[model samples]
Target chain A: MPEQPVPRTGASGVIHDLGYRPYDGPRNGSGTIASALFLSGFRNAFGLGRSGKSKVLPFLLLALNLLPAVIIVGAMTLFNANELPLGYARYASATQILVSIFVAAQAPVLFSRDLRHGSIALYLARPLSSAAYAVARWAALLAATLVFLLVPIVALYVGAVLAELDFSEQTEEAAKAALLAVLLALMLTGISGLIASVSVRRGFAVVATIAVLLLGNGVVTAVQGISDEQGELRVGEVAGLFSPYSLYRGGTSALTDELFLTPPTGAVMTAAYFAVMVLVGIAGLAGIVLRYRRIAGR
Target chain B: MEQVIRTRGLTKDYGSVLALDDLSLDIGPGITGLVGANGAGKSTLIKVLLGLVPPSSGEATVLGLDVIRDAAAIRARVGYLPEHDCLPPDVSASDFVVHLGMMSGLPRVAARERAAEVLRHVGLAEERYRPMGGYSTGMKQRAKLAQALAHDPRLVLLDEPTNGLDPAARDDMLGLVQRVGQDFGFSVLVTSHLLGELERVSDNVVILDSGRLLRASQTRDFLDATGTLLVEVIGADAQTRMGHALAAAGVPVQARGGLLALDPAPELGLDVHDLIRDTAFDLGVGLVRIQADHRRIEDVFADA
Candidate 1:
């Protein structure tokens, strides 16, 4: 950074006045403010504008998340496989833990730090309203999470096309996976963001988010696995509704031709899964807005 | 002058506790000081002005805009430095201020330029690129002030700008605040529990006590000469000798904190200044100083 001109000092060693230039430029409204906040929050999720230590965790997780896709692509190219080995939608399911960890680790960075450090007051004291602040942050996290979910899928899609696979089929599958990723990103951002906002403590927020995303998914997966063994498909399908990852899986199974251990069967079950998942996501975002409103009011 | 802030019967009641009680006041431009002890509703009043907290039974207008109806407009034109810590630890002060400047609706280039200017004004030019997590309390406070000023609002409300600072740093912060209001052409409403600090920079002073307005007047009024002279003599038992001599000489002199205090009475037909000088000379003591004692903001609370 270039050095700013130091205030001149006089004979008595007193600092002279460096004129404070008033801003006579055009100022944008709240919409611009909210978009600026959204962009900043998006950068914060991956530690782009933060300290060196903060960058380590998010990038490490991103690298870990992308590793499997790279290995699968290499294997496909080396073997000259006629079919794409990994399903685009199934890739997220296979790497669900990485996604869960990323969301759990990063949600607090976006949602909790401001509240925890009392910096939310600075933001609220601006032209932006508390609800707008919350929504902007939520949208930023949604965008970042979408990036995380889409990168591997895009990598795989590129690999499939490069390896002489059917372009249209690959495009159709990637588009479907992208749609499911949006839905999944919406729900994940909401759940983790809400938990981080309410909990305040970063560690507790991370643990709670992981519990809601990973542990809940694990239990549901176990129940689904057991029900599959018992030929009780309905029990497994209903249990899948309890976790975001399971909801994503049910979404993937319903929207795409991907096979699942216990997929929600029929049009009604699939529609119900989609509705509940979207509702939960909306509710979480609402909770975050309400939480910030309360803080701003205080 | 038009009122920068006008509050009419402004009351903020938190169940079982009243933060502000039927307060009515009009504050014009220049640096006005809000004085109150802890829990004296100083913070509450700022919050209400900023529209972060709503008044329960009254109304307020900041910059002639209704606090409720035009809160967004008020916020756009008014800056606020919250009493609490508000800087993010991880981000550099430059980045944080620019981001907040944008959040205040400044364009990107304007935000960046304004952030740098304000940071420099607050004496954080070199350290602006450093993460605030490593900053000293004074540096953090400066950074906070920088962000508040980044958008060049017409008015800035600073809550206890000198809080948690050593005497030197506190003086620097107060100096910065004074320049912000006077040289920079921004109206300021700064709050402090330390009455003396505000008296130096504030054009007007508003004192609050137990959720009620204790006093609101020009800083000069709170600091008006109380018609008493403080006498300080440099000698052995100077205060005792002066007290006895003044009392014997028909002057009602009282010793207070190593100084003799006396009120001049016309009826006595004695030149008080000459008497003090003569007494000190006769006693072989050096007259260190003699000056009028002024009433401080603390005296307002005492009088109340």
Candidate 2:
């Protein structure tokens, strides 16, 4: 065999022998690669590894998402109301618009940039399988959105605690809020990630996501406004099952109505609400995974 | 005798447009340059090998692993530098490369170390921290190359790596590719549209035209020697005088503008080269240079 230019030290400085060395080291499997993508996608969502300009929108939106809870909690402190001024689950519903905007604006940063610039090739050309890549990215977006949604709930919980509210109920509400917020983030990231994956233009993806999310609210409200059954609107309640905010509220209302001043709704409505929420969340996530698999193949 | 990459009846179609047409190749280990014109399916071939795109109707293996059955396994071992611009502009080269390193299954410490090593190897020592958005085209290309090498792939597929560089940077990139193959001992399949650019670095050259294999041969073989010699002698009207003398001495000679072509029959055994030297010495025409007439890579197009 001809002498290869593998590195061998001489008496003097090393010669022009080797520019790169073959890695005999153990290659981490798909799990590590998937975790890496998860970390990268998570950082990208918050613009951590990106430029200062790219950092602006997500941070601003996060601050805005938490602002309402801060203010309401602060007001509760000022009022000296012994009972918790605002409920945990209600915070998600009340600030759903902020969460929606955050998901819409940031999902593009996480998903569309890779598709638009063709950087998906870089991610796919590794140990990570296409499904792993998709799932990791979805996990990142879900986690990021959860952070956006949960921080405010925590702030509200802390504020309510500081306001001298009963501790036991607050803990339960906080736990419920955490669970429902996670569920809500999963649903939003699923739909938004799917949309952003396909839309090559970042602007178009942002608009499309906002439109889809906000349109849910508009459609749910309009359906509620138009359909009145005798004295109550079962159609409105059923339509509320379609919107994430309503589904979450409806599900949480089934377990406890501390967040809502009114009584818990019927068990039949609760079952349908919980069923549809979990179903759509799961189906949407599967669709997103399959979408990325197809995209990676392309 | 082990083929680094082998494909049989490989075909790919993007909907109605066919990118590869029954292409088959068995490339050995070395710097093999994939040369073709625009839309000649060079990029598609790399994509197929890397399993980025599946073959519509064929079979292929890279590093001896089946393309379809072991795509993830193949990708884990092969690095890809895509043809078009694919770098994320906002991320700094260091951070981007480190992240890509981890994606290739390197531990965080290993990834960071590899990122720095590759960035330095690609000549981006200090400026690797700057955002790629602020980088020039050449810088972006270097950064892209760094990421491809960051994982220490056994083989790297570089598609049009010097696409937008000026002459100097192009030469630099070609030199780096040569080093990667020779010094690093990694198999390289670097693609380019310009046939001439691969002449120096490529041990083997594969030329594709219109989605079909036009030529596949060793670079040295591709440059077929005409069994002729380019003879140039000093002094005015020297080529004419030498040609006449060579012909009179029973040698077949042709004047090539200012030079003389000495293509002699081997069966003659007349020692024509020595005879010409002696004759030139006698005439005092001063043989300036005598070299084998080699085929230029551009000559391939003339066949088409």
Model 2 bad stretches (over 4 Å): A1-19, A228-232, A252-266, B13-18, B209-212, B231-288, B298-304
Off by over 4 Å in 1: A1-18, B237-243, B281-284
List the lowest-lDDT window of 10 residues for candidate 1 chain B. Answer: B234-243
Q: Candidate 2 on B143-215: residue-level lDDT in tens? A: 9899999889889999999999999999999988898889878899999999998999999999998789999
> Could you tell me the interface RMSD of model 1?
0.8
Per residue, candidate 1 scores C-alpha lDDT tens digits across A1-298 of 9999998757797766658788899999888889888998899899897777888998998999899889989999999998877799998999998999899999999888998898989988999999999999999999999999999999999999999899999999999999999989989999999999998789999999998888898899999999999999899999999998888889988888888878988999989999988998899999999999999888
> What value does DockQ give for candidate 1?
0.76
Q: Which pairs clash in model 2?
A: none
The DockQ of each candidate is: 0.76, 0.57
lDDT digits (tens) for residues B181-273 of candidate 1:
999989999999999899999999998888899889999988889889999987648678778988898888887888888977677887889
Candidate 2 chain B — worst ten consecutive residues by lDDT sum?
Answer: B264-273
Write model 2 residue lDDT over A1-298, tens digit each, in one string.
8988988578787467454655666668888778778887898899887778878988998888788888888788888877655677777777778888888888888788888777888887776777777788889999999888889888988888887788997898799888888778878988888888888898888888888788877787676666643435666787787777667766677766644222225777777777777787787788877888787766
lDDT of 2 at B45: 87
Clashes of each: 0, 0
